[model samples]
Target: MSASLLAILVTSVLLAAVARRYDLSSLLFLVVAGLTVGLIPGADHISGIELDPDLVLYVLLPPLLWSAGLESSYVSLRENTRSIGLLAIGLPLATTAAVGFVAYRTVPELTLAAAFVLGAIVAPPDAVSASAVGRRLGLPRRTMTLLGGESLLNDATALTAYKVALAAAIGASTSLRAGLETFLVAALAGVLVGFALGKIVVFIRSRLDDPLAESAIGLVAPFLIYLVAEQVEGSGVLAVVVAALIAGQRHSTAGYAARLQDRAVWKAVQLVLESFAFLMIGLQLPAAVEGLKGTSAALIVTSALAVFATVIAVRLAWVYAFAYLPRLVPRIRSTEPPPVPGQVFVVSWAGMRGVVSLAAAFGVPLTTLSGQLFPGRPQLIFLTFVVVVGTLLLHGLTLPWLIRRLDGLGDQQRADLLAAAAAQDRAAQAAADRLDELLSDASTDVDARAADVLRAWNQRRRQTAWERIDDEGVESPMATFRELRLEMLAAERRAFLADRDLGRIDDEVLRAMLYGLDLEEAVLNRG
Candidate 1:
C-alpha cells in the first residue's frame, strides 16, 4: 500500500507537470492517470491506492476546506451573494430532484430512496476542482467568486440532502420536513462551532509569536472545527468553511512572514492533496465498475448517459434562470452586478463533479440494518464514477477554449488591476508609516541606514502603483531604473552560481548570498 501510494504521488506529479503545457487542468490529468494506471496489468495485486471514505471525510476534507475558506475573501462572498446563493442552494436542489427523477425513471432497479441517494451523491459541484480549474483559466473574478463561494457551501447542502436520502434507503423512516430541520440544525451548529473555534484560535495565535508554530496551528485548525461540528451533530464541512473564514479574516494581524509562509505551505499541501484525490478517483474506477455483476452492461451505460445529461441540462437551465430572473426584480437588479453575456455558460459548464461526489458514493452503506443488501449501492458507485469522469473530462478539457472563445477576461483585467493598484498604494503607505514608527526612537547609529532603506522600498512601492494607474505613454524613470537593477541582480545571481560551480564557495554560502540578492530584487521589482 505504501509503495502504491508513492506511485500515485509520483504519477500525479508527472501528470500535473505535463498538464501545465496544455488547456486541461492538473486535476483532469491526474484523474486520467489514476484511471489508466489502475487498469494496467498487476493493478489488482499491486495497487491499494484508492479513496478511503472515512479518511477523506474526516481527515482530508478539513484542511482542504479550511485552506479554501481562508483563501476566499469574505467581501467577495457578500458582493456575489445572490448568484452564489442561487447556485449553491437552489441549483443543488434542482439537480437533485431532476437527477433523482431521471434515475428512478431510467433505472428500474433503484428504489426512489436509492435513486435520491444517487442524486445527492452527485449533486454538489466539487469546490476544490472549481477553485483549481477556474482560477487557472483566469475566469472573470466575479464568475470565479460565485463559482468558488458556491462550491464551498454546496457540499454541506448536498451532504445534508444525502443523509436524509440515505436514511430512507437504509429503512430509517424520514420526511422532507425532518430533512429540512436537520439541514438547518446542522448548518447552524456548524457555524457556531466554527465561530467559537475561530475566536479561541485567534486568541491563541496572538499569544504565540513563533511563525513555524503559528503555521502548525493553521494545519490543525480545520480538523478541529470539523470534528467538533460532527460531534455536535452539525455539518463538519460547513464548520470547517466558517472556521477558516473567521480565522482567515483575522490572519492579517499575524506577522507578515508567518502569513506568507503559511500560504506557501498550504499551496503545497493543496497541490499534493488535490493530485492524490483525483488519482484516487481514477484508481477506484475498477472497483466502481466491478459492481456490474448480473446488471446489464447496456442498461447501466444508458443509465449513466441519462444521469450525465440530466446533471448538465439542469445546471444550464438553473444558472440561466437565476442569472436572468433577478433582472426583473427592481431591488435585486439594483444591487446585483449585471450579468456579462456567456458568463453563465462558463459557470454552468464548469460543473465538473469530483472528490466529494465520489466520497459520498463510496460512503453509501453496503447493507441495511436488517442485513439485506442495499438496493443499489453498486450502481450508485458506478454512476458516480461515470458522472465525475464525464463532467471532469468534458468541462475540464473544454472550459479554457470556451472561455477564450467568449473573450471572458473582458474588462475583468482592468477592474482587477485597478483594485490591485489601490491595494498596493495602501500597503505601501502602511509600511512607510510603520517604518517611521519603528525608527522614531531607534538607537542613533542604526537610524540613518534604516531610514534610507525604508525610504527606497517605500518609493519603489508607491511609484510602481502609480505607474499602473497613470500610464505615462512612455517609459517612466522608475522603469528604466528597474531594468538596470534587474540586469545587475541577474549578473550577481550568475556570479553566485559560478562561485558554487568553481568549488571556491560552499553551496550553503552561495545560497545565503543568493537569498539576499533575491530579496533585494523582489523589492526593486515589486509588481
Candidate 2:
C-alpha cells in the first residue's frame, strides 16, 4: 500500500487500542500521535505529507459534520430549537464582533474588517470533537443535541460572515441585496441537492438486498452530497447535514435487513474516519508551528488569548440571554424544558475550535486583491492553531470535572426508574409464559422451538428477579460467559485459518465463515 494509506490504517488501529486502554478520548490520542510523528526528523519530508487546506475543508469536514447530524435525532432538536438557534447563530455572530473589536483595538496594524474575518474563522465549535466527547461523558441528551445542532448551523453562518468581512477588507462595499440573494441561493441549492441525493440513495437501498453492498453505498452518500453541493456553489456543509438527516430518517423506517446493514456499516465507518481526522489534525501541528518561525512569541500569545476569550465570552453571553427567549414567546415555551443556567454554561464551554477552523485559517488567500502578501497570514494560522490546542486541551480536559462540579452528572433516580421499567417488562414476559406455551403448541416446529427457548429464558429471568428482590442485588454472570465464548471463538478462528492454509478449505469459504464468526462476536459483545 502507498504510504498515506498505510499511515492512515496503522494510526487508526493504534489510536483505537490506545483509547480502549486509557480513559482518554480517542481524538486526543490521535492528535498526540500525529504531532509526535510529524516532529520526527525527516518525517515532514515524506512524499505524502501534503496538507491541502481545501481538501481538508471540502472533503473531510462535510462528512464529519454529516455523521454527527445523521446520528442526531430531529425530534429532540426541534424541541430545543430555541437554544440551538441562540447558540449556533446568535453566539457565533456575537463572538465574531467581539473578537473583531478586541483585535482591532489590540493590534494597531490589523484593520477591523480583518479582525472580523479572523474571528469568523474561529467562532464555530468542532462538531466532531464535541460529539465524540459529549457522547462518551454521558452528557444529557438535550445538551448533546444542542451541541450537534449548533455546530451544524454555526459553521455556515461563520463561513458566510467570514466571506463578507473578507470582501469588505478588500474595499468592496457590502450589498445587502446581493448578500441575501446569495444566501437564499446557497440554502436552496443545498436543500435540493440533499433531497435529490437522499431519494437516489433510498431508491438504491430499496432495490439492493445484500447487506454489505448496501452498507458500502451508505458510506459514499455523505461525500457524494458534499462534493456535489460544492461543485454547484452551495454550502457543502449544509448539503451534507441535510442529506445525512434525510438518510437517517429514511433508514429508521427501512426494512430490518437494510437497517441492520446501515447500522453495522456506519458504526465501522464512523470509528475509522473520526480517528483519521483527529490524527491528521495533530500531525498538521508541526507545519503550522513551522509557519510561525519568525513571528514574535508575544504577538502570537496576545492574539491567541484575545481570540479565545472573545469566542468564549461571547458564547456565554448569547446563550445566557436567549436560552430563556422561548418562555417569553409563550406558545413554544411549553413544548420543551427551559434551559437553566447550568445547561447554558455547558453549551458555552463546548465551543472548542477544531478541523474547520484550522482549514479556514489555512485557506485564507496567500495574497490580497491588491497583490499584497496577505498580512500576518502565517501569524494568523499559528495563533489559530494555538487557540485550537488550548481550547481542546483546556476545556476538553476540564469539562468532565466541571460537569460534575456543577452537579451535571447523570441522574441516578432517572436511571433507576428506567431500570425498574425494564424489569417490569421482563416480569410481564414471565407472566405470559403459559399463554406463549399454549400458542406454540398450535404452530409449526420452528415456532415451537422458538417458544420453548423463550419460555426457558422467561423462567431464568423471573428467577433472577426473585433473587434480586430477596438479596437486594443481582450479579451479572454474562461477563464470565462472554469471556469464555470469546476464548472459544478465538480457537475456532485459529483452527479455520489453519485449515485454509492447509488447503482443506477454499478462500471464499474461509472468508464467509470468518465473517459469520466476526458478526457473532459483535452481537455477543453487545449483549
Candidate 3:
C-alpha cells in the first residue's frame, strides 16, 4: 500500500508540474497518466488497486469541499446568488430530467428509476475542473466567481436527487411530495449542522495552545461537519461547505501562526488528495467494465453519447434562458445586468462532469429488495464513466479556445481592480487623517519607529496602483530595500554552503544556518 501511494504521488507530481509549465489541463494530464500507466505490463500493484464508493464519499470528499469553501469569496457568491441559484438548482434538475428521459428512451431495457439514477449521477459539473481551468485562463472575476460558487453548492442538489432516484429504483416508494420534503429538510438541517460545527471548531481552536493542534482541528473540521450531518440524515456536502465558509470568515481572528500552519497543511492535503482522486478515477476503468463482457460495444457507445448530449444540451438551454429572460422584465433588468452572450456560452460549456459522478456510480447497489440484481447496474456504471470522460475531454479541453474565439472575456476583473484601488485610496487617506489627529493631540502615546513604519505602509498601499500605471514602473523604495535584503540573504546562503564544503561547519550547523537565511529571505521575497 505504501509503495502504491508513493508511485501515485510521484506520477501526480510529475504530470502536475509539466501541466503547470505548459498551461495544459492538470486534471486531464493526471487522468492520462492513470490510463497510460495502466497500460504498462506487470504493473498490477497500481492497476490492481481498488477503491470503494463509501471510502470516497466519506473519507475524501469533505476536505476537498472544505478547502474550496474556505478559498471562495463569500461576498462575491452573495452578489451572484440569483444566477448561482439557477445554475445550481434549476440547471441540475433540468439536466437530470432530460438525461433520464433520454436514457429511458435510448435504452429500452432501462427503467425510469434507473435512468433517473444515471441522470443524477452526471448532473453537476466538476468543481475541480471549473476552478482549475477558469482561474488559469484569467476569466473575468464574476464569471469565475459564479463557476466557483455554483460548483461548490451544486453537489448537494445532485446527490440528494440521486438518493431519491436510487430509492425508487430499489423498489422503495418515492413521490414528488416526499422527495421535495426530504430535499428541503435535508438542506436546512445540513446548514444548521454546519453552523453549529463551525462554532465548535472555532471554540476548540481558541482553546488549543499549540498551533499544530489548532491546525489539526481545522483539518478534521470538514469530516466532523460531514459525518455529523450524515448521522442525522442530512446533506453531508452542504454541511462541509457551510462550515468551511463560516470557519474561513472567522480565520481573520486567529493567531498568525495558527493561520500559517493551517494554510501550509491544507495546501499539501489538497494536492495529494485531489490528485489521487482524479488519478484513481482512470484506474477504475477495468473495474467499471467488469461483468459486462457480454454487453455489446455498440449499445454502450450509443447510450453514452445520448447521455452526454443530454447533459451538454440541457446546460446550454438553461443558461441561455436564465441569462436573457431576466433582461425582458423591467424590475429584473434594472436590478442585474444581463450576461454577455459569448461568456454565457463559455460558462454553459464549462459543465464538465468529474469524480463525484464516478463515485456515485460505483455506489449503486447490486440488488433491490426482492433479491434480484438491480436493473442495468453494469450499463449504468459504463454510461456514467463515459459521460465523465466525454465531457472532460470535449468541454474541458475546448472551453479556453471558445473563450478566446468569441472574445468572451468580461471586464469584471478590470472593474474590480478599479474598485479595489478606490478602496485602498480611501483607507490610506483615513490612516493619514488619524495620524494627523494623533500628532495634533496634546496627550497621546505614539512610538516614533512604529508610527513611521505604519505611515510608510499606508503610503505604499495608496501608491501601488498609481505606480503600476506609470510609464517608468520603477520599484518603490520599500520594494528596492526588500530586494537588497534578499540579495544579502542569498550571500549568507552561499557562505554557509562554502563553509560546509570546506568541512569547517558540520552538516547540521550548515542546515540550521540555511534555515534561518531561508526564513529571512522569505519575508523579503514575499514583500
Q: Write the per-residue lDDT of candidate 3 for residues 1-527, one digit (tens) a residue.
A: 77886787677777777887897778887887777666777877887576667778887899999989888888999899989999998888888899999999887667999999999999989867877766656678888888888888899999999999999999999899989988998999999999899888878888777998888788888988899999998999999988888888878888877887788888889877777777877776766777578878888778878888888889989988889988898998898866877778878888888888989998989899888898888888878878887788788788867776777585554555677778879988998999979977889878889789988877876776454343456677656766777888888888889999999999999888887787667655541
On residues 79-106, what C-alpha lDDT tens digit does candidate 1 reach at each position? 7777788988888888888999999998
Error of 1 at 276 (Å): 0.5
Worst 10 residues of 1 by lDDT: 43-52
Could you give candidate 2's per-residue lDDT for residues 243-347 as a string of tens digits? 777777777767777676666666776677667666767767766776676667787778778777777777777776677655788786777566656667777
TM-score for model 1? 0.89
Between 1 and 2, whose TM-score is larger? Answer: 1
* Whole-model lDDT per candidate: 0.83, 0.72, 0.83
Better of 1 and 2 by lDDT: 1
Weakest ten-residue segment in model 3 by summed lDDT? 464-473
For model 1 the local lDDT of residue 527 reads: 51
